[model samples]
Target chain A: MIRILIFCLSLLCCHHLVARKPEPEHIQIQPVFGTENLKLNTYYLLNNHTDSILIETLRFYISGIEFFSRGECVYKEKNSFHLVDLAKPQSLNISLAGLAGLEYDQLTFNLGIDSTTNVSGAMGGELDPSTGMYWTWQSGYINFKLEGHYHSGATKMQQFVYHLGGYAYPFAGIQQVKLPCKPNQNHILILALDYLLQADFSAIHPNIMSPGAEAVQMAKMVAAQFSLKE
Target chain B: MIHVPLKLAVICFGLAACRSNSSSFEKPAEWPEPVYDFSKNPLSTEKTTLGRALFYDPILSADNTISCASCHSPYNAFTHGDHNVSHGIGDSTGTRNSPPLMNLAWHTSFMWNGAINHLDMQALAPINHPDEMGENTAHVLQKLNASNFYRQLFYNAFGDSTATGENLLKAIAQFMVSLVSANSKYDQVKRNQASFTAQEQNGYALFTQHCNKCHTEPLFSNFRFENNGLPIDSSFNDYGRMQITQDPQDSLKFKVPTLRNIEFSFPYMHDGRFKTISEVLNHYTSGIKESSTLSPLLLNPMVLSSNEKVDLLAFLLTLSDREFLFNPAFAYPKELFLPAPKD
Candidate 1:
C-alpha cells in the first residue's frame, strides 16, 4: 500500500512537469484589397494598429482577418472587426492568447468599414465616433479616415478629414492594406498623410459623409499610394 | 467566481433584467396581420415596455429636451398634431413635416422622401442630424447606462444588461411596430360589420379608380416613389428621392404617403406645401409638372367638382380610429414617472 501511494505521488508530479508554458506568438498580417496585398510606405509593416510595442501611432481598420501558415488557412473570421483609432487605440501588449510563437507566414485584414456594420447599431471599442470614422448622416460610417499637415501653396496646413467609404454603388468602400512582418520580429507601420499628396490630387474627394460610389473610387485612388520594401 | 454560491448572483442578475410584470399588447380581431417581421425579434411585454420608456424619456436628445414622443405623440396616431414642419431639439425645425407613425409595419420605407432603408436605422437620422436631436448614439447609451431604469429595461429586452446599439434600435422598432392602427370605420366597412353611406361609397369608388392605383386599399398607400407634381419651393427646393439616388430620371419623385386618416395627417406632400385637401386635389387636377419623373397616372387630370371633394373628405374622415389614438397602454406610464409629462 505504501509503494502504491508513493507511485501515485510520482505520477502526479510527472504530469505537471510536462505541462507546457505559454510562449510569445509569431503573427503575420497581410492586408488584401480585392485581389492584391496592400502595402504602406514601401514596407508591409503593421497598417492599422490600435496598440503596438513597435510604434507610437498606428491607426487603421481591419476589414477582414485571414490567418494561415504553410499554405493551409487556419483561422478566418469574415467579420472579425478591428479598428486602430488614435482616440481609442489599444495598448499593444503581445500575448499568447491569440497569436504567439506560432508559425504564421500568411494573414489578411480589411482596411475599411463594411456594409453590415455601417448599418448596425452603436459599437464599442474602435468604432467610437472619437475615432472619427462615423459620418453624421445620411447613412453608413467612414471606412478610412486620415488627417495630417501638408504644404498647400507653400504654407503647411492641418486638420483634414480623409474619410473614405461607399458600399452601395455607385459608391464602393474597399480599401486593401498589407502589413509585412520582418522575419522573426514584429513590424511597425507608418503611413504618413504624404501618401495622398504623392498621388494625383484630382482623383481624391475630400470630406465624404456617406458610403456611396464616390467614396469607393477615392479609396482605390488612395490604395494606389501604398508600396512594399522588398 | 464560478465556484462561489451562485444563488446571490442569480438574484442580482434577475433583478437587473427588470422583466415586465405586465401582460403583452394585444391586437383587435378585425385588424389585418401586421407588416413587421417578428421572427427576428419575438414580441414580449418586457421589450415593448422598455421601448415605451425610451420613447417617453428626454435623455435621447442632445440636451435632454426631446424624445420620440415629443414629435410623435400617442394621441395623434403617433404624429405631431398640426405641425407642417417638425420641431426638434432647441426649437430647430426640420424642412419636412412630421408624419404619423402608426401602422409602420406596412411601410416599405420611412420619412417624407424614403431616406431611411430600414426601420432600425430610422432614429439615427434624427439623433445624428445637427438640426434634429443632435445626440450621438454613444452618448445616449452612456446616459442610459447611468440610469438604473434604462439599464434594467435594456437587460429585460436583451438577455444581457449591456446596452448596445442593436438593442436600442430594436427596442425602438418594437415600440413602433406595436403602434398598430386598424380599427377605423373604413376597416369595419371592409369587414362587412358596417356599410358606408352612398357618398362615402362613391368616394371610395373614385379612390379605387383614380387614387387606389397609388393609395391601395386596406393599407391606403402603395409605398412607391412618385412625382405628383408640385411647383418647387424657391426656399427649400427639396427633390425627395432624387437626392439619394442622384438619377435625373428620379428627379421629383417622393414616397407616396399612406392616405389612412388623411384628414388628420395633412397638410399633405413632403414639404407640407398643401395645408388643405382641396389644395392637394387642385394640384392633382391641373398642376402636375411635366417632368420625366412624374407618375403616369397623374399625367391626365381628374376634375373632382366641389361636391366630389366633400365626398372624398367624407371618406377620409372615416379612416380615423379614436380608440387607437386614445389607447391608455400607449399613454404616459404614470406608475414609472415621478411627475407626469406636461402638455
Candidate 2:
C-alpha cells in the first residue's frame, strides 16, 4: 500500500513539472509597403523623387528569426525561413509561436536567403524551387524581387525589374536586421518604398539579376528600408 | 597501430551494409565534406530507383520523345556524343554543349556558365526549355499522376502517390548524388595500391607544375569560372559568365570542365569545338588568345615540348574510372520498365 502511494506521488509530480511550462504564444509578422498597409498589385507613388513612379511588385525572403530577452537569446524558430510575397497577400503575414512566459524584448532576422540554403540542394516549403523566386539560369535564390514602372513627364512609362541576389564572396546579399518588440503584439514591418526612388531608372534599368556590384548595392538598400510600422 | 586493421575491417563492414541500402552517404578518403545536405532529403533505394526511371523516361518530356538520357546517355559518361551541341525535341539544336555529369555531390554550381546553382534545380532548365523537353511542372505532374506505374512507384518511394514538385526534384537529386567517381587509376595510385608508369610519372610532374593550380588534384578540376584564353566565337559570341553576372569583367569566363574519363568524353569544351584531346592540348599550348578576362594562370604560355605533351596525355588517361562508367547499378532500370521474358 505504501509503494502504490509513492508511485502515485511521483506521477503527480511529473504532471506538475509539465504543467509549469506554458504553451507557446502565437506572434504575427505583418509586412507593409509605405503607409497604406495595402495589398499587392496596388500602385503607390514614390516619395521625394524627381519623377512620379509606381511600384507594383515587391517580394523577398525573411529568415533566421530569433528572440532575445535581456540580451540572451531565449527562443529561435526552427527552420525559420519564410517567403514574404506581395502577389499572395497571405504569405506577407508570418505567424510565429513564441515561448510562453519568456519575455521577448528584441527580434532579429535576415532580410534575404542565407548562403547555406543557397548552396544546399533543392528545398521544399516556402524556400521550394517552385516559388519562382529561384533563378533557373543561376543556382542561388533571388534575395529580393522589386518590379515597378517609372513615369517620366512624357508619355512613355519605363518598367524597372530589380532582382537582388548573390551568395559567393565579394557579393553576399544576406543582411541581418534587428528590432525591439513587445511580446504577443502584431508588429508590422514597413518596407520604405520611398528609398527606391533613389534608383536612376534610365541609367540602371533592369538592374542586378545576378551577382555583381549592382546586386550588392541594391540588397544593402533593401535591407535599410525596413522599419517598425507606427 | 597493430589493431588498426581490425578497426578498419569493422568500418568497412559497416560501410558495406550501408551501401546495400541506398539511403546513406559515403564520404570518400581525402574529399571535402559534400555540399549536398542529405539531412533534408535522405537517400533511399526506392527513391533512387524511381529517379533512375524518371531520368530515362520520355514521360518527363512534353512530346514523350526526348528524355534526359537523350542528351546525357549513360554509355558516353552521361553526355551525348553524336552532336557538337545538344539536340532537343523537334531536332532543334541548343547553343551550348551538354556537360558530362559525374561527382555532382561536390559541385557548388552547374552548367558551363555557372548559371544553374544546384543539381536539383538543373533539370528545370532542360525540362522547360522550348527546344528541349518543352514541358512545365504542372503538365508533367498531371502526366505522372495519370500513369499507374508512376503512381505505385511514387507511393513506394515517398509513402504516397502524390507527384508533388518537391518529391519529384528530390528523387532526381538522390540518383545524381550517388554518381561518385573515386575508383580511377589515379585514385588507386594516391591510395598507394598502384604505381604510375615511367611515362605517366614524368607527365604527372609536368601536370603538377602547369595544371594543378586550375585543375586541382584528386577532384581534377577546381570548378571555378576562368577564361582559358579561348577566342570569342564570331558566330556564337558566347560571352560565358558575363551573361549571368552582366559584368564586363566576368566576360569569357566558363566553369572549368573535369578531365575525368577524357578518353570517352570527346567533342569537348562548351561549344564542343575540340574533337580530340590533342586539339585541346594544342589550343592550351599555342592557341591561347590574349584577353583582359583570361585566367592569370594562362597569361604565360605553357611551354611543353612534343615529348612532354605525349607524356601528359598518358597521365590524363589515369583519371578514367571504368567502375563508374560500367556500373550496372547506374544503368537503366530494365526490370522495372520492361517485362522479363519467360524462359
Candidate 2's displacement at residue B194, Å, is 8.0
The 10 consecutive residues of candidate 2 chain B with the worst lDDT sum are B1-10
True contacts kept of each: 0.20, 0.61
DockQ of 2: 0.40
Best by TM-score: 1
TM-score of predicted structure 1, chain A: 0.59
Q: How good is chain A of candidate 2, measured by TM-score?
A: 0.80
Query: Which candidate leads the pack in DockQ?
Result: 2
- What TM-score would each prediction reach against the true structure? 0.79, 0.78
Tens digit per residue, CA lDDT, model 1, A16-132: 786555444423233332234333223222223221111122355655655567666555664466665544424222222445445655555566777666655445556654344
How many clashing pairs in candidate 1?
20
TM-score of chain A of each: 0.59, 0.80
